[model samples]
Target: MLLHILARGRIARSPEGELLDRYLKRVTWAVKHTELPDRGGNIPPLPAQARTVLLDERGKQFSSEEFAAMLGRWRDDGVREARFVIGAADGHGDVARGEADVLIAFGAMTWPHLMARAMLAEQLWRATAILSGHPYHRAG
Candidate 1:
């Protein structure tokens, strides 16, 4: 399945962007990153058979293993694309949240949007690694 990250705001050239890129590079699965303006901008059309995941403060927090299992199931079920969306500072609207297949959170604490992007990248890498039985993720 394709892992697509649709995040708001320009990441630009920064340490966070570099970190995000580094993790994404390690992911064996297909990956795509799209950036939207902090305010208004056109979001790319969702591909057919795509599942949308919205990152929200009130969302459920899943363990790395659980996340991997979910992704594996989606892939096995022939999901073409899994789009993870990171909204702007004000966060996502009710309509967007309602339309999402799932709403996930890093934790209760608030994270900077850039750092969240990097963290999400790392988690994606970790999830794929865990699914592939990679030694990179050692769970107790």
Candidate 2:
């Protein structure tokens, strides 16, 4: 399944952007990244079998094992894509959150939009590696 990350804010040529690129490039699955303005920009269209996941403070925090299992289940269920949305500084509105299949949180602490993008990219790589039985994850 395609793993697409749609994030708000310009990552630019910053260190965070470099980290995001490095991790994303290591993922064996199909991956795509879309960068939007900090405020306004339409997200790309998703495939019919796509599932949207919004990254929000109010979202559920999943353990690495659980996260990997979720990805595996979705793939087995024929999900064509899993699109993860990272909102701007103000975060996502209720309407936007409601449209998502899953609301995920890195932690209760708020993170900068750019760092969130990089973190998400790394997590995606980890999740995919875990799914493939790779030793990189070292799940506890």
The candidate maximizing lDDT is 1
As a TM-score, model 2 comes out at: 0.96
User: What TM-score would every model get versus the actual structure?
Assistant: 0.98, 0.96
Output the lDDT of residue 114, model 2.
85
Give the RMSD in angstroms, all C-alphas superposed, for model 2.
0.9
**True lDDT of residue 94, candidate 2:** 94
Clashes per candidate (backbone, < 3 Å): 0, 0
Worst ten-residue run, lDDT, model 2? 38-47
Query: Where is model 1 more than 4 Å wrong at Cα?
Result: none
lDDT of 1 by residue, 1-140 (tens): 99999999999999999999999999999999999999999988898888999999989999999999999999999999999999999999999999999999999999999999999999999999999999999999
Q: Total clashes, candidate 1?
A: 0
Model 2 Cα lDDT, one tens digit per residue, 1-140: 99999988789899999999999999999999988888877778778998999999999999988888999999999999999998888889999988899999989998888898899888888989998888998855
Stretches of candidate 2 exceeding 4 Å from the true structure: none
User: Best by TM-score, which number?
Assistant: 1
